[model samples]
Target: MSSTLKVGILGYGYATATFHAPLINAVPGLKLVAISSSNATKVHADWPQLQVCSTPEELIARTDIDLVVIPTPNETHHALAVKALTAGKHVVVDKPFTLDTAEAHDLIAHADAAQKLLSVFHNRRWVADFLTVQKLLASGQLGRITHFESHFDRFRPEVRQRWREGAGLGSGLWYDLGPHLLDQAICLFGMPQTIYVDRVLQRDGALADDWFHAVLGYGELRMILHASMLVAHESPRFIIHGTKGSYTKEGIDPQEDALKAGVRPDAKDWGVDETMGRLDVMRGTWMQHSQVANERGDYTRYYAAIRDAILHGAPNPVPATEALQVMQLLEAGMLSAREGRLIRLHH
Candidate 1:
């Protein structure tokens, strides 16, 4: 492999334009060489020097490309990743790995057969607030967490005419946002023993589910993962209650907004979130409340690690097995919602 890996993105859609392209360019050893998109004009608007292929097949067939990133629709992830792996290129698929667990398994088999690196883009693992929570828990500041709640709420009252809001297989809040929350929870605490989900379409004329509440049970601990499109008031992004103390944080990570605003990842203050989390603990007889500074998030670390994995045999940043675990939880959550009962996970 060359010292600099050439990368080709499969789509110029929202995920690609906002997250993949910029982060790929930010890393030193990864080169954003080309993009496969029908709209060459749109591709050139942001990346004027990039070679725009008219179709995904053209990009995958290019001999110069060492890595292929699939940031297309959720349903297309498995197929595109298979193609990229068959072409002997390292593959990266945006989250919700695939529409279902079977598809995810198929993609993993293809990558393994081809002897190539396969990774999923679970970018939220590097979110500023999440990193802070990870550090806090590691320090034993929040001892033996008993309850944890994570929310990804928004106030989009109107259901827009998009694939995400349409009545498609992978076009709902559960499939769209559930992966991030599930992946993060699995990172903090291993796979849960059981999962229960309640999904609903709360907005008028909403063809797909716009709200969901999922609970994962880990022995005595209860984890709540929720998302809603009708929340008008701001809610705590994370709430944790442990035997020793509690930690509550507000506001989402600023990286996504910064990327949408065309801010480069190399910006001096990139991923610096000013919103501090409140940490409350007992001080002998009184409860003490203090502010905990957030840790900076850098999505570039993901791609940088991927580059090293391909070039220097480093471990994959987000391995296929880890992503497969997330897919299993995703499917379990759906089943729990459909059956209106708790779904037990078997290892």
Candidate 2:
């Protein structure tokens, strides 16, 4: 419970650049003390003052580091997280937690055994559009959600030569974007009663699935989760319909793009995108719409929560168990897609 918690970040790829660095820099009581990356050139160029290592093991072995942020490839999350927890360091692993629920459970077991704080970086839950949706729902504007559709589409026709675009256990859009969208849905409306899925590899040379459409059955409510790589244009990120009215918002969160361009988390226009999403509603016989500015997405909160949880006994913002639930949903989605059957969830 030191006043300044020293932190170490693993990997310097997209996750590290777009999330770990900026957010770590923004949070109080958390100092970016060290980093581990095979190619530390880029990270060193960005933060020259920190101690840079060549491996995660070396980083976590250092007693000076109290917290470790794992932003490695999807296949490595479970292993790295378990290792960090065993090293007596609080850990933050990026989603989707693991390839399956078994691996997630194993990591959870290790974390619990070590009595370490483990959390997942489900940053999409803090997206401006999601926050806006929360506001709308809290206002009781979209009464008793009957139908909901959320899309996390992209227009990358050609599969880049990366782990994510390959045919591996944790590759593809299902593993890459599934956790973000699904976890947000789970947070808003508890786990769905049942799930049905449809998945496809639209591109010619694509080795992994690039398109997926999942339907979550909640009695009278049907929630659709969609993601595709070949979409030349994307649909609204959120579309909700209820008994009283409907809300439609089209646009993606700006934080990712901001962090990519070396924009620090504390920038004045940090989460601002001129093309912010708009909400359209249809109530009774009248149609009403307003372009509400997307709420400011504060990634800083994740680190802040971690600091408080580790130092002040506050609850972990994205608990390891909550992440396991997301992994369960992802596994169920994949299983349902392959078997062409609906998955009946247990509690």
Candidate 3:
């Protein structure tokens, strides 16, 4: 109710430490007043002013908090978000919004009935490389994009024992990395007609799938989304062949790595990175052109949108309907992977 939105964070793990905490601190009209974490010592060490509670229930019960950001695990998103919305707090859930689409719908309905804002943190939508791709596509530099390929290959051969890689609900590269790839694709190309998926557990003693290759059918355009753990090396981060030209780039965005290294969001060159793609066009024979420096990634925009929506009555930037569409794409991808067929999406 005050000028600043009082935010109570649920869980203080990787997402909270890397994305939410730093960006929330950087935003002007938000206060990180409380947090819920079992590891009280670690919480205090990182954020001394934050009031650490033992449970999410305790944090949500506080009348002073207006927003609850759930950076919990992939599986718990639905239940925690539902609880937060029912308790009358606007909610911002970290992505892979829910393990299933039905849960997302339920949460949306609850939030709508409560007249509260509900958003999923699809932050990669603002990544420098993705923005660059958007710019090229809009400028028609790629002509008619017939084929677009995105690779998120990594070199970790050993299986991580964490829940993300272990055998459980909401595990595997598909659920973990699928949202980013799927959301970006949906943002650019809208819903694909069909998707052909090939999923595998390539690593030794791997409990869940660590590799995936999904081909999305975008009418005349054929887009391939791929990820693997056994890859000792990585291909170009992006490769697109359009009618007029082709663009290729070969490095991960530096923002995530920077955040992992404890870099503040306010630092110079914070989200600026040198991982831009080169465009080769057909002028007479072949003309190669280097892309300009990437636009700075502004993750704070996500929370800023949330603030304006809650305070100023603007529309939620990442609409619940779009999040539902991403969920639909995820479910379709899973079905295609399991059945070895192209899953068709009905509008």
Candidate 4:
């Protein structure tokens, strides 16, 4: 248990640049010490205080680094995480934890054997809208939830020439955004009994699935997760219906754009969402509707929790076991889409 935990980030891509580095720097006990990337110009420009390692092996071998954060790509996550764990460093992997559950299991085993903390960066669990929904469900404001629909839509009409836009391992919108929705749903209502989805490559020249509409069955309750790259007009960020009434919220979380714009986690307006969700409650015969203020979101808590877990024996922020459930749902959804039928979850 170290008072100040030195951290080494394993990528310079969008995830590392936008979320991991900034959040880690903002956390009190976690220091953003080094980065592993062949292209160090961005790392130098953004965070000159850090050292740049040409290879991941070199970064992992550094004696000062206490935690290893992998934000490179979906395919490299498993290998890099395993190496770090075996090298006696705690690890954090960007979500869609690995290419498959097999890889995830092996990494978990390595972390357990090393007696180190292994966490997934499912940062969206702290999204403002999600926090609000969690509070509402817990408060019993939306009683007996029957239908839950969540959408992570975008307006990208053309595919870019990148690894994420291809049909390779861990590519496409589903593998990218699907974990967020699945993790959120599982957080709200345990695991579902069955899963169904329609995976589509909607954009022109798209090599991978750009759209997906998945339905998770929780007995009579229906939870839907949808994402598309072709949406131009606005849609509700969340549409939740229950026996009492329905709760609809428009506009996505403002944290992502803020983080990309160089806003630190401790900024004055950090985690503040200007857009609030609408809640409709039934009172006898009449329907009453009102705006529910969005809850403040804090991604720094993830890293803070990581620090505490290492220093104070607090629980892992996003434990490997919990993340494995998300991977199971992801694989089952893919199998359902491929077979054109509903796949029952045995675990």
Count of steric clashes across candidates, in order: 0, 0, 0, 0
Kindly provide the TM-score of model 1 when superposed on the true structure, using C-alpha atoms.
0.98
lDDT of 4 by residue, 18-51 (tens): 9998898899988889999998887899988789
lDDT of 1: 0.94
Which ten-residue region of model 2 has the weakest summed lDDT? 272-281
Q: Give candidate 4 regions above 4 Å deviation.
A: none
**Structural similarity to truth (TM-score) of each candidate:** 0.98, 0.95, 0.97, 0.98
| Number of the predicted model whose lDDT against the real structure is largest | 1
lDDT of 3 by residue, 1-347 (tens): 77899999999888898899888988999999999999988988988988998999999899999999998888899889888889999999988889888988998899899889889999988888888888888999778999999988889998867888899888999988888899999989998998888889988999988999999998999999999887777578889999999998787777788889989878888778776668888777877676756766878889988988898898898987789988888888888888888888788
> Candidate 1: where are CA atoms >4 Å away?
none
Against the reference, the lDDT scores of all candidates come to 0.94, 0.85, 0.88, 0.92
- 205: Cα error in model 2, Å: 1.6
Model 4 steric clash pairs: none
Q: lDDT order of candidates, best first?
A: 1, 4, 3, 2
